[model samples]
Target: MDDAASIDGDTTRPLSQAELDALTDQLIDKLKTVFDPEIPVDIYELGLVYKVDVSDDKDVAIDMTLTAPGCPVAGDMPGWVEQAVMEIPGVRSCKVDLVFDPPWDPSRMSDEAKLQLNMF
Candidate 1:
């Protein structure tokens, strides 16, 4: 039997709405464990993650950004996000989409993140 079937006793049952939400939450939590290496705060709290999409097939796609377009870690940040998201229990594949549409600013950061950086 497949892993999903083993977990729920039926592979055709399909992941319920609650299960999908739970899986998304799990992936977010794992993302919180990842850092930019230069920033003390997790990328999530820093307002880096803009969106997360999980398909019924267990694939996860993340849209995110960095503090700066020229940030030295640009090459590695996406990889970090992909790795963290992949650690989620039900994710079969992970992809990170880097975006700079609105641009990142101090306002995008969470209160906790601001406090950590002494921005207030």
Candidate 2:
């Protein structure tokens, strides 16, 4: 193992672009671990997350939304997403952008999410 790997006690090789993409996916997965207190499905599956951008410096920017314009957790979900992104090993920073442009509807949810929520 190399010095950095040894220091981290990780045996995996340094990540390439594909590996980094995988890490980004894993980071997204971690973000999904959190859920809207009122909803059974993850925000990711709910299509609340519109975009995830990772910069060259490993900073992450998330554009997300709530289930409704006046949801109770509106003030907190972005912070939750920020916290989740920051947990990624190489993430230097996280910025959450809360949006309502397209607005949220049941149709935005993933098929699995709809199935889980029995919306379908």
Candidate 3:
């Protein structure tokens, strides 16, 4: 689904491609501030974030996963992500969906994350 569509199937105001790109960038920056409690790397670079969607109304939706299903913060990480995204100026709302399908793998980590963890 396109980023402009809400989870409830509502369509938000239309935005220019440039505007969407800028919002996406901002969202990503906010996402970078969230970290896994057991991992030193930020979730973004760690590849925990699978997808991000933003609507013209400034609502944000994220699809993310944890390093493991048994991770201690499984119940709280989504809230952390939502709060971080919602704190951004102009964001109307933020929702995070935790997914396990196509489960997370170490190979998903970015090079920076790998380097930080000495995985390289």
Candidate 4:
């Protein structure tokens, strides 16, 4: 996913669909590295990530949530996610927002996460 918007000289242009797609893949890969600490699966697979938006300058905004409102690491997980996303080369900035609008449910977990947790 390092290939996303990795232009040689001009980086000020608005992201093309291809660049956005590649950047999205990179973002997902980075998100996959962040875990809930208590869960064996990463946050991405757990479906904690709600939305991701990338700016023309490569700034990233993410909306995510916890499995439970009272989760202990609630104070630290967003920072972890932001840090991970910032590791991408072309990313100028990263911001992670915690949201509970729809809340989280086991139904949100990916098939791989379900298999990992034996939810099936």
By lDDT, the best candidate is 4
**Model 2, 2-93: lDDT tens per residue?**
43344255343445799678877887787788798898989988889988887655667888888888999999888888888788777779
Report model 2's TM-score to 2 decimal places: 0.82
Report lDDT (Cα) of residue 75, candidate 4: 95
Q: List the residue pairs that clash in candidate 1.
A: none
Ranking by lDDT: 4, 3, 1, 2
Give the candidate number with the greatest TM-score.
4
Predicted candidate 3 versus true structure: per-residue lDDT over 30-114, tens digit per residue:
8899999899999999999998887678778889999999999999999999998888888999889999988999999999999
- How many steric overlaps are in each model, in order? 0, 0, 0, 0
Question: Model 3 — TM-score against the truth?
Answer: 0.87
**Which residue runs of candidate 2 sit more than 4 Å off their true CA positions?**
1-16
> Each model's RMSD to truth, in Å?
5.1, 6.5, 4.3, 5.7
lDDT of 3: 0.89
lDDT of 1 by residue, 1-120 (tens): 454533354354467899987997798798899886788999989999998887667888889999999999998989988888877776789999899988988899999999999999
Candidate 1: segments with Cα more than 4 A from true spot: 1-14
- TM-score to native of every candidate shown: 0.84, 0.82, 0.87, 0.89
Q: With candidate 2 superimposed using the best TM-score fit, by how many Å does residue 110's alpha carbon deviate from the native?
A: 0.9
* Each prediction's whole-model lDDT (CA): 0.85, 0.82, 0.89, 0.92
Distance from true location, Cα of 109 in model 2, Å: 0.7
How well is each residue in 7-103 modelled by candidate 4, as lDDT tens digits? 5765466788999999989999999999999999999999999999898898899999999999999999999999999999989998889999899
